[model samples]
Target chain A: MSLLVVGSVAFDDLETPFGRRERALGGSATYFSLSASRFHPVRIVAVVGEDFGPDQMRVFEGRPIDLAGLSKVKGLSFHWKGAYGYDLNEAKTLATDLNVFADFKPDLPANYRECDYLFLGNIDPVLQLDVVRQMARRPKWIALDTMNYWIRGSRPALDAVLKEVDILLVNDAEVRELTQEYSLIKAYKKVRALGPSTLVVKRGEYGVALFTPDGIFAAPAYPLENVFDPTGAGDTFAGGFLGYLAWIERTDVTALKHATLVGSVMASFTVEQFSTERLEQISQDEVRNRLALFSDMIRVEDL
Target chain B: MSLLVVGSVAFDDLETPFGRRERALGGSATYFSLSASRFHPVRIVAVVGEDFGPDQMRVFEGRPIDLAGLSKVKGLSFHWKGAYGYDLNEAKTLATDLNVFADFKPDLPANYRECDYLFLGNIDPVLQLDVVRQMARRPKWIALDTMNYWIRGSRPALDAVLKEVDILLVNDAEVRELTQEYSLIKAYKKVRALGPSTLVVKRGEYGVALFTPDGIFAAPAYPLENVFDPTGAGDTFAGGFLGYLAWIERTDVTALKHATLVGSVMASFTVEQFSTERLEQISQDEVRNRLALFSDMIRVEDL
Candidate 1:
């Protein structure tokens, strides 16, 4: 079964305490596609620009990623400038040139209609809904990720998409910001009330907690000795989560727990270096080894 | 075997968003003794004053808590006044009056000297060492909890106690604050370098992470609808952890994981209301029920 991912594919200028990179390949869809493709077949629907060079495009040479929906318009790609210091939780945005992404619309490929799994990455919630509308057949599982930018401003559209999503993933502060509730559990309940049957609240470096109608599942963020850059780690996590589910062919509550652990491992790797560089380096066995350790970290005796 | 706890048993005036409590029965040893005594015999080594009323003393009437070392001196008991806004992470100290506690000494009863498990709650490092020195027989397991104040101001004494203790439990920020390492995994390693073979870094509202020579174990914080007051929650967690360990008669890696979950349950109960009131209200059945749910929350398919 194939996985369909839709969001931005852009050039990112990032500065961190470890180092700096100019025009590094990044975007919600880019990170999501790179990670999900590592596990299952991925079809991406996103827009780039003429300035997005072939060097960036060649990153797809060996991966099972169908880029038929990746269109190159005659303008600059979505370019974002961000910085991180001692605290990796909050990214300082210096600039954002929406460029070609400003008027972007997701146009899913015909083959994408057959995808068994779909991920709506962080983007305008209205566009997220548009991607869902374009789907020829409803995927078995639909996971959506959105940021505070949409929750605070485009909530009506966000709520519309939330009503349709199987899972809604947001970090700690974003959940609080969205619901205006100080307590995380309260915030979680409010999100569930808005319609998603399952909620995955990402707490970078702390962990990811999943709430389902059956019950709750919590997995700690894999403790890392170093986190070089946090850019796109969340997107990478969403990809890893949906990718694993697509491969296993299950989206039950129990399966989501495994997905959360898989996502943690993928995000752990992404943070070891900037952008999706680390995600590109690890093999399937390496991913398996981390998953095994992660599984061991939470092994409990049956009561 | 009995569990030995040593720290100040003081009165606290606190203001939280829920409400305010004046001169509440609050202290590390007070909370720890209340939680630990539920599982095993607990001996408290702390000082109060003539002003310490009979109502506060009756909290231990039916429990297996030996208050032989709970001395009532001539002056006022140690007093603390603090406030918390919506953010319960950082408590703001409005005033502190360390009347009798200023010149206090822990006078452990002869029976307490032979207890098998000893927990040194958050207190002066110099005083913590003194309690160990007073012990005629070394305990089977010694768990120590201290704040950043002692970690920074009394490194030598803290180090001395750290070398002797078997377990060191600290919250997330304290470990980072103590080791000056922003990365939690790195910070865990640094704390292990200084002393204890087993370390539990508590993440209030997030959960507990256990680090041993063997490796790492993670547990989620028991989700709560409300956290009325967070005062002494950490101390209650320490009591729950050591209490379970004392009952299980082991401190191995596996045992520590179970103990972490137990502590989480205990801490969860403590925060439901102000001070130790919630801890006093719940029955053994409620604790076991919550622990069962907690175990179920992380139960996953073997990978």
Candidate 2:
């Protein structure tokens, strides 16, 4: 099963306690594609800028990624500047320049219209709906990620896309904001009522939790001694999660549980470095080893 | 195996989003002894004032709790007035009248000294050390709990108590404050170097995590739609955790892992209502059922 991700391919200026990087190859789609490509082929429908050259493209090279729909436009790409204090869980956004992304319109290629898995990253809910409409056939799974901005500003549009999504990936704050409910269980119930059957509440350092009608499953963040940067961890988590599901070709609870762990394992690596540096260079063996360790860490045997 | 807990046992006036209770039976040792007594016999050593009458004592009735060390002084019992908002994770302390607790001197009974397992609740480290010293022979396992007050004010006393502890259970903030390490892994390591081989970081709502030289184990809080009050959750967790260890009579990593989940299960019930109301009325069947459910929720089958 093929995976299609529609998001941004841009640059980031990151500063953390460990180190700093400028003009880092980033963006939701870039991280997602790199991470998902590790397990399955990913078709990315996102726009980059003219500044994105061969060096930047090399990050996706040798990976099972389709870039036909990744348009290289005339202007600069989406650039974000953020700084993290001692608390890596929250980032303080210094600036966000939605250059080419402001007037951006996702134009999926013919082959991408039939992707089995579709992930609409954090974007305008109206644009996300447009991407969904462009799909020739409904993908096997549609996962959408939204932020507080969209949830608060353009709720009607956001609700429209959410109705068509099977899984909704957003941070814990976003879930609370969207539902206006403090209790996570109640918030999840309200979210499921809106449409997406499963809600993945990503709690940065605390870890990620899955809320579904069947029950809830939670995985703690891989205890890391050094977190260099946390820029694209959420997107990387989605990529790895959807990628694993596509690889196994299963969306059942058991598979979703395992995929959630896989997603956590992938996100663990992303925070070790800035942007997609670690994700681009990670090997399958590394992922498998971490998955085994993580499974051991969280698994509780029968009494 | 016998378990002995030494901490404050008194009254509480609590206000939460759900409701309020005035002069409820509460305290660290009260919650810990009740939660632990479900699995094993518990001997409690703490001071309550004359106001703690038969009704207060009845909270521990029909349970395997020894009140031989429960001293009834002339003055008022320790009373705490607190409130919780929508975010139940943090509580606002409106008032804390130590009363008799201020001069609490834990006088362990002869039989209590030989208990196989011991838990020193968040009390004066000096008093905790005194309790440790009162033991005829060292227990099979000794766990200690502390707070930022002691960490910041009584470093020497805390360090002294830590040296004699086999396990240290404290919340995440306390861990960071005690070790001055931002990374939890590092903080756990630093804590291990101090004394206790096991560091149980009790993350209130996010859940609890165990950090040892061997590895780390994390358990998410049970998904609850209604959390009436989160007053004694951590104490309840410690009780359930050490109680399970005593029940199985094993201190291995596997036993610790299972115990951690059991602790989470016990704490889940504690927050369902205020004070010890839920803990006192909960049946073993309910605990076992939830433990089974929790085990199933966290268990990851082999790929």
DockQ of each: 0.72, 0.75
Tens-place lDDT digits, model 2, residues A1-303: 789999999899999988899999999999899888888999988887788899999988888898999998999889999999888888999999999999899988888888789999999999999999998999989999999989899999999989999999999889999999878889988988999999999998899899877878998988888889999999999999999999999888889988899899999999998888888788889999999999888876786
**Clash number for model 1?**
0
Q: Report clash pairs, candidate 1.
A: none
Q: Fnat of the models, one by one?
A: 0.83, 0.72
What TM-score does model 2 achieve against the real structure? 0.98
Candidate 1 lDDT, B168-190, residue by residue in tens: 88987788888899887788778
The lDDT leader among the candidates is 2
Using all chains and alpha carbons, the TM-scores for the candidates as numbered come to 0.97, 0.98
